[model samples]
Target chain A: MSAVTYETEALTGRDFPERAREELRDSQLRGNIRKATTTIRAKTAEVTGELPDWQDLRRAGQAIKREAMRDLARNLEALEANVSRAGGKVHWARDAAEARWIITNLAQAAGAEMVIKVKSMTTDEIGLNPALAAAGIRPIETDLADMIVQLGHDTPSHILVPAIHKNRAEIREIFMRAMGLDHLGDQPTELTAAARRYLRERFLSAEVAISGGNFGIADTGTICVLESEGNGRMCLSLPRVLITLLGIEKVLPRFEDLEVFLQLLPRASTGERMNPYTNLWTGVREGDGPQEFHLVLLDNGRSRILADPVARETLHCIRCSRCLNVCPVYERTGGHAYNSMYQGPIGAILTPQLRGFAEAGSLPYASTLCGACFEACPVRINIPQILIHLRGEVVREKQATLGGRLGAENLAMQGALAMFEYPALMGLAQRLGRVGQKAVERDGRIDWLPPGLSGWTASRDMPALPPQSFRAWWRSRRGRP
Target chain B: MSGAREAILGSVRRATERMPTGVVELPGYRRALGLDPAALLDRFAERLKDYDVTVLRVPEAQIATTASARIAERGIRTLLIPPEFPEAWRPSGPTLVPDSGQGARELNEIGGVMAGCCVGIAESGTIVLDAGPGQGRRALTLLPDYFLCVVLARQVVGLLPEAMPRLRPAIDAGRPLTFVSGPSATADIELNRVRGVHGPRTLDVILAG
Candidate 1:
């Protein structure tokens, strides 16, 4: 088997728990995320409740995705042929580095000093903006949230709303500094207007544009992008040359499958019945939109993820982010804690699998396995199940290492297993535990312990050991000893 | 690039070697609204209002008069239209400029653009525009601040599923398509929806049966 090269720059340097601990201390971020998630949750519920056949639609969506993944190679080949037949060029990228190189070369070939961009997670995954800048091409983000993130020199914290962690006042500051405005208000209306004015000139002058595809129809060679602002329309239409980086797993077998996804995505993502604009194009047109178009099929760790049957369902995510909104863990810790472009329950499973257990092993333990994500998923990806499955993988990977073999956790588990196999040792240990509890017990709870076991008691209180073991009590009550 | 393509495909093929290869059957679901024509139109108008779009229902013969009054009310002097736009429906007050590969800056200077639609999805209140004869190109409806779309009642479908077949021809012809539900909007600022950001801010729809 060939070794997979996964994305490293986008993954986290620190473990999820440590990062989450730091994120939890930011009261402003907490407030912004809480308000945004709560509002979106209600909106999603209201719109989804209106459709009587929502469950059936979700089922159809899941089935279609399964069918797409089953013959992914064939579907991709068909998509390539169809797109090429329609006067568009297709490129294949094995990893993030290759994708970045291809996109930068294309930008250089176009002789573009500046490129307009539509907000796309695929580009974020590959860190395209920095790569473009290094190549001396100034990439401008046209989406309002993306613009805020770019101008502020901040990373996106949410899937749908990139700047969800920033409130109006913070956004106003970013806009003032970035756009060189003397005065700006904190109201959303004023902020939106300022962004419109700032991006309008760039949109008109942009010679090259980059975008991410939401869905690639294999049958008709069409690419679909959904957005609320007209910025997407501008990036897709106004540029002379266009380039789109699409994840290979995003391809669908037929265009009719949109009948299922188009209904589920908007409701799940932004809690809207439908977004303001959805742009679909087959390929290059004579005089309609961009004269030249390039589609780069990206396989950065996706094929590796497809190898694991249990984890392959992670590819079914449509980036709806409903899971994040409903997740108790994500609602509190937010997206940055996950240390990847993906966050929440989906991220916990997906990151570990894609980046391998070595780089993102701690992510699987980030969730509480509450199953809320599974319930909210449009395609019904069993996220909790996948999290548990990846957790097992993480443990196995750890045990394979020398540090893991002699680790405190492994030694403790081994000792406990030995005691459980012998009844006399088990009884003796229970008696010793009962006596040892006196030193730390206060009333009926043990709030603190020595260094080796204090980690468990740090955030929660443990009950005191009972006077008698359950087996001992049962034997005495039955008059058997 | 071809080497990378082959390697990726080979990896995928190996990964799915154990799985079955036949097509998976899609679930049977309710795909259509099943409403009558009148109800569909009513639902379409209602959904459009939900998006804050201006919906005007007029008789087929009164489209030009109604559009002229709206244009006057909005104080629009120059209106952009596709080359194949019906001459009978052209309002009298505005100077209609036919789209002819105008630059983006030039298109932005126009007050509004009027075009016909391919299909109107009633359930979602979406208007699909293929860059066909009357629709001109994608840039015509875009860049302009105001948009006026004339949707004949016959073009309205009850649901997204019903509209797909109507759009298949455009897909086959390889024309670009745009589905506009409402004027440009954004809720990225603390999840508060602010309308009219980038696309046409004011969407005036003349629904003439």
Candidate 2:
């Protein structure tokens, strides 16, 4: 990587502990999130209660997503062929750098200085906004939730509701503070109208619009977006140039498969029986939505993820935001705490794959392994399983490179791995620790363990070394030694 | 206009190619669902309500009466309906506008009206408009604040994938197809949700027998 690429893609350098501390400090955001999530959860429960077969829908969605990710290359090729035959341009981006370059050039090729964006998590994953800003182009957000988040210059907190961390009062404040519009009140109707009025002008004037698909139909070459606000309609249709940034996993086998998802997504995320707005376009029809449509199919870390057998299920996420709603950590810190565009359960697995571990190493550990996210997931992604797998990847990242100290983490990991490889060494170490525990113990807790052990004892009290560890007891009882 | 139109269509075709299809069949789907049709619709309606979408069920003959009642109850005037709608089906209190729009956006300006559709998904409670007859255009279902669709239970399809092959003829004929699931919604500001951001605030589905 060059200085320029690293300059853009580098981690924010906000260490995990600091980020967690600062994010946890926002008690108001936490309260707001708790209230909003609980409400949606209740609504979802009430609606899902009506469906005896809701679990089956979730199973079908999960199976479909799994198959799509497993056969990524072939399916994508087929999709490209169908879409090409129908009349669309597909750009394959290998990484964020490539994706950003292609998008900027597409906008530049159209000679557009201003662009409008739909609610797309993929573009944000590639940091498209900063890229546009860097290229002297502006991208405005059309999704009311997105617009509110953008106007506030804030990161999206939830997948379904990026502005979930904010309330009506905060929006009123953001508009007044950022847009300089006065007399803005807190009524939902008035606030929606205010956003509609602001976005109306942008919709009428924006030269291009950027979108993210809920699912890309492989057979019919159709792209789908399920939203509650008609704002998605304006963004998807009104602009002259339409650009869609979609992950490889977003594709489904057939256009008809949308039925299950259309049912599954709303109930899981917003607790709605159905999505309010679902737009499907095969290709540009005469005098219909956006005249010029371009699709950016991003690989970034997907190909790397595809290579992994056990962890590939991580890509099955549909971005329904159900996981985030159920995630205890997400409900606390919101989206920014993840420190990447993709956040929450899907983000925990996806970001490390797309962006790489060196930058997003902390993301996998940010979760409590609480299965609430997985339970809430419409497609039933086993996120906690993927989290442990990615943690292993992060631990073993010290592959032979021209590195200096090998990061204390890497050295500790290597030493542990070495000990695990030898039964004798493992026993020796356990015994040594057991003997050493007396020196460090205070009131049934390690008062001051070794430097590296600080992390373990920092929060909870480490129990007095378990008497004789199970291995020793086993050896003594079974006479295996 | 023709050349620019072709160019646009060409790009769209290219973008369509970017999507992937690797469909896998789920096991025992019907058995898992327990095969209770009416129960599923009830659950669907309940779920729609949870999403802040209004749900209303009426007999086929009562569609006009129910629609008129709903329009008046909601205080929605200046309603727009397709010219193709049966004369007897027109609501009594509202001004009905013809489906013909000088352009695509003309119908979106009207308040709300009923439209005919090709299929309805009972399991999920979605309405499909093949743009045939009273379906008008895509904007007819999308642009208004309160959208009421009269769907016969006989037209309801179990699946979209199953529904597509049947609608392929209309699609091939260049008819604009609109599949509506619920009313427009957004949770954009700090995750606080508000309904009807861009589409209808109220979606009333009159299930005709």
Candidate 3:
């Protein structure tokens, strides 16, 4: 029932800058990203402004998440006890491979040939579909966006709308080619109709179902999933056997903590006060839902993140993707530029910590330190500060590998320190620098520079040695010299 | 799996070694609207109407007549109802489909489902069904295209905080619950909203006194 080969996301050899350069060239992708983000950004501002106590809500959200992290062990124990008392089986997985093995065994135990799924970012992060496919169990995506992505044989680009990179025409073509249909127009409603017809039978007949929890309450051992389309209800209700995979960080201390996240997530993600469907189930019920329930609690590098006091807040993300909508870099390059399942500012900080700092060094530098992500964050994560901390960690690691010192960077810092130590030497160098730039100056700016320093000049011109340096002009004006 | 659980829990315990096992004060949205029953009903109806869910308010005596009219007007040929539903509330127009542990395919063939809600949230316009009494099983209300729910005015709660305590019994009993705010809708394709996906495409509320 279990196999060693699970299809997780493969790492591209290319870094963010390389992928961003390619994404930037596609004007159609750029237009799609910009239009979608602009609409969501405006709508979020309007809806979030209606509540006068939004700041209080944000603060409360942060506090509750902090409390959960502070006492995760106790809450987890309570959750396990409650789930056991309610007759649901619990399994723990240390990484993605172990998680896949557990879920595959469950599906096989139930004699399931195919499984239905709701839209869950955790499953995407662990690459659950490909694994299930490899084990000869077909996993069908029931969400509208996920169905589109699965049919198109593409990866998800955005968190909320995974197929945001594709327009309606592309979706129609995917439906026609994949589902073997014709005469479909480019209207979203028509394409949705096609999906509804295609997936309805599967939803009714699928023997097993898999989902990722939005919030897990420790006290009641209840799992909450919020979704707009009724696919979530279908997946949660119709199947005979159910399996849910959740990250360890999704636990809340109490069942009532849902009010805060329920307020924060929908408004931030889709600009709605509440989504259409919010499903909560404690465990296996006799005649109602699935007869058997299994929960797989996945670590997958979260404990390492929890150990870091400086970077721990990255775990508080509710996967809202609000930061993505407000991000200029994400707006221009789109989610595909990030080269990971998680994208945008939240992804920039979270991906590195989850995968480890050494493997994802370039992710920290992906941001412009614009502070918009922090401002838009529902939990007030202070993402910029975390990025800076990760940057320092990367720099320190690199320096250690370079025999305790970086070559050019070390020499430049030493030179600056030496200059700052002597006022006369600094003044003399400033004068010499003014004279030194004459060879490269073109219309008072240097558009090209020497080797090793050409990266700055490649993007924009550098002001050629500002006439005299501010200190020199200040001294001259005051006649202090 | 046992080894994995121990390893995971060990790592978590080590990571949170500095945490104290005491009562931690957490900031939360503690505001609960203290509205009277009538005001709460009005607010709940308004909120439900805001989501494009039709809300019809009538006296308790008129519930049977109104439900019959609604079933006829909506052209519902077969309506599904739980075994515990009030005999008086059954409409005279449509053929009532009994809750006989029907499968998804059978439920899908039904025209509509009418159930009694356990609670109504005023702030979010939500109707919660706990699979108790006349609510039937989860699949009955989910597979059908149209859902008509009856919510007594007294069952309306002002906020989520006020509602959760009332829902504790169902939560503890591990009953399957559904929180339906409006008809099934999606903004997946280019963030444009299109209604009627997998769940019921139409939701009508009978706010009876």
**How does residue A357 of candidate 3 score in lDDT?**
53
In candidate 2, position A218 carries an lDDT of: 83
TM-scores of the candidates in the order shown: 0.96, 0.84, 0.94
Please identify model 3 stretches exceeding 4 Å from their true place: A1-13, A403-432, A441-446, A467-481, B19-23, B28-30, B34-39
Look at candidate 2 and tell me the lDDT of residue A168: 83
Question: What value does the lDDT take at residue A115 in candidate 3?
Answer: 96
* Predicted structure 3, TM vs. truth: 0.94
Q: Which portions of model 1 miss their true places by more than 4 Å?
A: A1-13, A419-425, A442-444, A473-481
B24-90 in candidate 2: lDDT tens per residue?
A: 5684444223436676567556545555556677667777888889899888887878647876567
User: What does the lDDT read for residue B142 in candidate 2?
Assistant: 65
Least accurate 10 contiguous residues by lDDT in model 1 chain A: A1-10
- Runs of candidate 2 with Cα error greater than 4 angstroms are A1-13, A45-50, A108-113, A133-137, A205-207, A399-435, A443-447, A450-452, A466-481, B1-25, B31-79, B87-96, B104-109, B157-177, B189-193
Sort every candidate by TM-score, greatest first: 1, 3, 2
Per-model i-RMS: 0.8, 7.7, 1.5
Which ten-residue region of model 2 chain B has the weakest summed lDDT? B1-10
TM-score of chain A of each: 0.94, 0.88, 0.93
Candidate 2 reaches a DockQ of: 0.31
Query: Would you list the clashing residue pairs of candidate 3?
Result: none
